[model samples]
Target: MLFFSIYNQKGVPLLYYSLQHYLSLAGSLIFIPLVIVPAMGGTDGDTATVISTMLLISGITTILHSYFGTRLPLVQGSSFVYLAPVLVIMNSREYRNLAENKFKDIMKELQGAIIVGAIFQSVLGCSGLMSLLLRLINPIVVAPTIATVGLAFLSYGFPQASSCVEISIPQILLLLIFTLYLRGVSFSGHRIFQVYAVPLSVAVVWAYAFFLTDGGAYDYKGCNPDIPSSNILSDACREHAFTMKHCRTDASSAWRTAAWVRVPYPLQWGIPTFHLKTSIIMIIVSMIASVDSVGTYHSASLLVISRPPTPGIVSRGIAMEGFCSILAGLWGTGSGSTTLTENVHTIDITKVASRRAVELGALLLILFSFFGKVGALLASIPQALAVSVLCFIWALIVALGLSTLQYGQTSTFRNITIVGLSLFFSLSIPAYFQQYQPDSSFILPSYLVPYAAASNGPVHTGSKEVDFAINGLLSMNMVVAFSVAFILDNTVPGTRQERGVYVWSNVLDLVNDPTLVADFSLPRKVALFFGWAKCIGA
Candidate 1:
């Protein structure tokens, strides 16, 4: 066995083991900011809460998943795939109303939605619903859904990059160079940099950004102690280092004056308030997250274990993700968890797939989260740096989406039509809604928003004004792409072999290997109760 294997004891040094854990933590730290969006005119404490909460949940979830869930080396963290919908719900008309709680009310409702939505996700995994769901999905549906996830978030990355182009552009270029070219290049034949590539590249770019922005003293008030404060809390004094100066002074002055070692517990924000419409939206996000996690499991298993994961582990991973998402809501992180692609890359680069190393990283993250200053320190990273990180990360995401095309017979017209139209409309509809809001009142209902034909089309124009209002939402790229791909793939008939259904179904059958399911399964009655013990394909 390799010295790094969790199942073996091959005598790796303690310091080396610790360094592995540190790299894993660094791999996940960048992801925290992706999930931590402050409210407009919001305070630094608010940002801190977001940062801290994400850290705590991610750390705990990683530990839990390593032990109780997949038992793989996957690191759990804030999911960008789930971000678009939560932002939509946060910006919804009904959610904006707050008597005094302001953004706290927003956090509460988000927490509530996540908690409730997670229940549905858990059911899908624990009750064998995922098996049923997969029977309906093929490469046509999978490719579009996965691809649209990256596409849907395109609006997120570019704007942030453009917001501070001078610093962002250089940062993006630097990060791309480091990860794409410098990656796996041996350092004195020791390969130190290869193992710590993500974090190290981030450190270099961040230092450069810090120098360029001069620690955000130009437009920031809090950075200069001589200047008076801005009353609004979440507002950053400086825009670099995640506006840490702003967070401490304006956002969470109370925290600045408060004690250290503030451990995060459940409901740190407040009781979650579920909204019927908003919860419905989050439920959809949850389902999308489920699919994304399943894909991550399969991909990670193939990379780490030289084969795809059996169906048992896939369902188990999904269930654990849902269960942990409920914890995220209780902890007030506002969104659920998904596997970090970066960490998987880290495993490949380092050639260390030990579960214990990941678990140790989780423990260290949990320890780091107690020092709220750590989150603040991370929060202070420049937006330019953030945009740079997003650019590199999103490129990988887009490539991952495209990778799904390999599963289908891409040369066939049927395959091309399914992939092309779904992808085309997915990008187009969301773009249309963003650019032009129709004035007609024939808009889609809250539940049917994801099912709308097209914003500009003549689906239902009885009330043109309503159509104008809802067009923007109904035309979300993911919703359109997934719905289109799903319907077409199912209704438009082709042979199982031609459609690649046979190959897909064959994967599901791998779950039927009694030894595969039994090898790491929970004891006796518990596994059966959760429906995780059965071989679905058999």
Candidate 2:
């Protein structure tokens, strides 16, 4: 199904493939900033800045990963893996009632935590500790761990989208139609509609909603359009006020406020504030991100070159991700960069595994980041539409995560129980912790309620930092799932075949095979210079 193989450098085809990749990046990649920045009490302009910075960091990190890491065509960006912990950090007791400088304070905290976690990840990978851990990371551990990430957001998805059912419903329906029903309909030998499903669905439904807005569908006679929904004094307008914010095409002022051109630079938010509590939270999250990226790398390598990269290569990829995340931290993205799970699906759909094309697509992302309006325009997308897209996206993550079970014996009772228990406890244990010391006095948004336990959870270790770390980690679905699956899978007895062990290439075999060397080895000069460090994937 490959339209272009891994080494293909043909210009026009590469350009087309790159554009496809870029379009794919537009939806999920931009959604992170739109969700996170606002939740931190940031302005529309701040949201736009974060979006642009995410793009820039994504582009830079992906390019680094392709050439110097596993050498696969995986894209890197801000990920949902980091979303829960960031929310916990932002909603902690110390930050709950900040009257001023709220956004910058939270962002700087995130940056410091991300930097510490990134450094830890770098050491983990560069020291080759990751490869040793791979033996315990079979499909049994990965399937539920990754699935828990998607399931973690179940409360947030529909509740947010339902605010503007008119827009959100149509978006969901249109996207489903394009990706499912109309997928067979091709254009000029390409499945253009299916390949561009997210963007196309957004466009069609966005225009439809624009017409509804312009036609005064949500207009309230006495409501002040400039004020927030809570400020509406008229009872009649108060009910409709909420609708105006999400349904209106111009609800966000990002477009009006963002400059025409701007470039993102490191430390733009301010100097980060390092804290033991936040750093511990992110360090755990970084491990989950590494595991998530490992799944992506294994699958993408198969699509690109029909074999998984060697353990050393996987280690290199993780190291590169950590280094890239350091850059993301300095840039204050509020999230770390990692290999996107969507890359496997993108490669399967487009059949464009060419490294050159991926690099070109990354270059395009970098170029687009310089245009401040691009970020503003993306930020201006209606909240309902963004959530609608996320609903489908989170479902896709679940599907993809479970699909990894194909590598193992999915019919086995042991595998099934481990996965089921992990998932059930992942959600259930968090609920118990979250409800242990519930605060009835503070009113928070529906989406942020799950993370509210960060301020008043049951875990009291005397030391504030220890209590925070325990509470925060336990509250995260992915962390709990990963811990359970990893421990059970390692402790329980099962054959390699039954466990569905990942078949990573041996370092000796990798060094011996010329083809694999070509596919995954470091650049010639770098390899020669760092030959002494080969034990650690140098």
Candidate 3:
């Protein structure tokens, strides 16, 4: 059924398919900066710069993963798995009150934390610890842990989109229709509408929002159009001030202020400041990220190769992802890189699993990164419209997480109870910590208030560092859900079949079927170079 198989290298199909992948990934590629930069007190220029850097790192890492890692056709990018932890660090007590060089200082702290965590993750994988850890992970554990990642931000997604319903609602509706209803519609023998759903919806809604702004939809009679929202004195105008800011397509100056071209480099923000508390937080988050990637690796291999990869191959993929995250930390992309969960969905929909297409798409991402205006243009997307897309994305993540349970005994009482409890407590426990915030004066937007649990939560262990680390980890829904599920699934388990322990193809299988060796073994020259490492599943 595949239009292009894993090794297919037709030049024209490669080019067309690669472009399709890039367009599908564009919104999410630039999403992190739009969410985190403003919270860190960064400017539009900083947002655009981070977006560009992320694109560059994603491209490089995807290519690296294709060559040396699992060699799957999966793309690597900034993952939301790192987002909750980063937000926790950003909203910590000391940084909360900083008045000078806030953006640079925060970026440096995050960089240090990410580097330390990435190093730990690299050791965990390269040293073969992940293979041991895999024995404890099952679909029951993975299901709720991954789902909580998406559910953690329920407060933020739609509420932010509601800020400009006129634009955001239509955007959400259009995207749904394109991806669901009109998905069957095709052009020139290609499902162009379905393949380009995200960008097409954004373009249409963006133009409509532009017309609204140009036609004075939010103009106030007593307000000066040029004045900042904070400076507007009229009470009547103040009511509509937030609307104008979010609805107006010109609200951000990223495009006007950005340069024609710029290359991102290491330590562009400054030398990182290593702190024990933040580093500890990121280390734990990195483990969660690895757990997230494990499921993706299994599912993607099944979809592409009809067999699971050996544990050692999964380990190498995790290690390579950690190395890529190290690069992201050095360049300060503000989030770690991982095999995107969306990659599985993309392959399923596109029916193309060619490594050449992914590599070519990555090169296109790299080329786009060099254009400062490309990142700026993405940075300039209206906040509400962006939030609308995120709502759908987060929902999709939830669905995908649940879908993994299909590989297991989904109808079993044990699996259902474990998943339900993990998800319930993940939400319930975080709510308790977030509600315990003692400082009422610290006012953040409603959605961000959940992430502010690090500052004034009830965990008081005397040592500020200990308290910060504990409180921050507890506040993250993924960490809590993972701990619960890992414990329960390991201890109160039933049969291996009941637990749905993933059974990877073995060395004997590869030897019996020479074709699998071609599918998974290292390139011939590289395999010869690392013959001694065969015990590690290289």
Candidate 4:
């Protein structure tokens, strides 16, 4: 085991880990500006202010997630799951055409939803009801449910890659080359090759941006001569006027207006508007985030400590995620925080699974976010490059989702169809909705109409509450896919082993978990006094 002053179990300082930490932190940090720039486009705040809020909330929550929450080394940072719904809430009819006030109100509604979701998650965690919520999920259900997370983001990811096709294509190529071919290779003298490959590849692309923009550190002339001195990306270097210059970097004249230090106060954007549709959507997304965190917790445990996560750990981790979500909502980030398997993937690349190193990295993320220049620097990144990086990130997530299928032991056609069909249709509904927004032709059956009415999905009777529910349910693509798979997977005849639930369901089996025995010892005693207590954390 490695040990150091910063760490006790591992004594020697592995500079590789320090570098790896920074790169991973930087990679996730870039997304803050990337996500914010789009929302704030043609609106308020500069790169520094937006990034500061993201870093502030993410950093604080990450610390809680690491030390107090799940106590896992997993980094709690930005998430894209809320991206769709947040945009939905922002564009809701209530706030439309409201001008400058629209931006503030939209942000408020988003924040309100986030806070509501957080409270729901906290109760799920602290009360131990989350386990019950996921008891029915198996690999087949999980397969498509998890896959949906990535599939859902394709719309957002593809647009970024398209912004500058030329810049993005090469970045995608390099990311694939590094992650696929070189992540495992090591030179005769160098052993940390796999670990170094990811960050090094990302560094190359980032540096490539500087050269592509103006050759070198504002040489004011890109290195490429043949591409065309007048090319949109290249000429930005020579003339200092980029076709997508702002997209490339966060440096804006507006950033100069940023205060040296910023403190993100609650309701800084505007008064939060509580809408049923948006709130429920965030709650569902937070639940999805919780489920994702379970996988991350399990993966982290297995990868680092060489074992599965105990029920107790899983419970606490989820509870912590809920608390962090509360923080995100209060901070008004328009989204909640969750653990990313990407951080665990980083450990695989580096071969250094040092918990202290990871925790320290989270701390650094919080601290550096205060420095306005850092956000400005990140802001300077080209949009195409950001999109290229997102493409790489989402591809990994897509693969991560697919990898869950291996545990299903999907040999029989019966099982294969379940997985395939779920994915196909899950993908279909979202694509259809994207292609054509909800229209009058898409009508629900009479029995289901009540739910649509309850959620106010399609048909509206002028009740905002009714309409909110309708919109929230329809917008949630994963719910449709998951319900289909869950119903089919459970009802279809397949032996427990064939379904992989024999092993996978152990994740849900609380009776045999010793840690859970101790955890519930006090609760069980308390349950004797109250019948509902049995269900609270049972």
List per-prediction Cα lDDT, in the order shown: 0.63, 0.84, 0.83, 0.62
Give lDDT tens digits, candidate 3, residues 83-181: 889888888767666577888999999999999999998887776677667767878888888898889889888998899999989999998999899
Model 4, poorest ten-residue lDDT window? 445-454
Clashing residue pairs in candidate 2, if any? none
For TM-score, the strongest prediction is: 2
What is the TM-score of each predicted model, taking all chains together? 0.80, 0.93, 0.92, 0.81
| Best model number under lDDT | 2
Residue range 1-538, candidate 1, lDDT tens digits: 2224655543454335545645644534545343445432235555665677777788899988887677788888877766666666555444333345667777887788888888988888777677567667766777787777767656566665565565667766766666667766786554655566557777876666555445543444444432234323434633343443322222234346333667888887778887665666677778877777767776678777666665556667777888899998898876787777667656666666777767666777788788877766666565545655666666667777777777668788888899899999988877656543323324422322332322343335576544523453455676678788889988888767557652223433544456544554445324433345333311
For residues 1-538, what per-residue lDDT tens digits would candidate 4 score against the true structure?
A: 2222346544236444654655665555566456544553333244455666777777677777766665656787767666656655654445434365555566677778888888887777666576555556667777777777667666567664665665677778887776677756667534343444445655677676656545433334443322223454554554444333432332344455555666777777766767676777777778777777777786777777666655545666777777787777766766678886777866665556666777666666677767776666555556677767776776667778778777667788877999888888777654443343323323421212222222324447687766665555555556656767888998898877677662223443445456544555655534422222313534
Query: Cα miss at 372, model 1 (Å)?
Result: 1.1
Q: Is candidate 1 or candidate 3 better by TM-score?
A: 3
* Candidate 2 global TM-score: 0.93
**Against the correct fold, how does model 3 do in TM-score?**
0.92
lDDT of 4: 0.62
Q: Candidate 4 — which residues are off by over 4 angstroms?
A: 1-6, 9-19, 25-27, 40-44, 95-98, 187-202, 215-242, 245-251, 435-464, 502-510, 513-538
Q: In model 2, how large is the Cα lDDT of residue 381?
A: 87
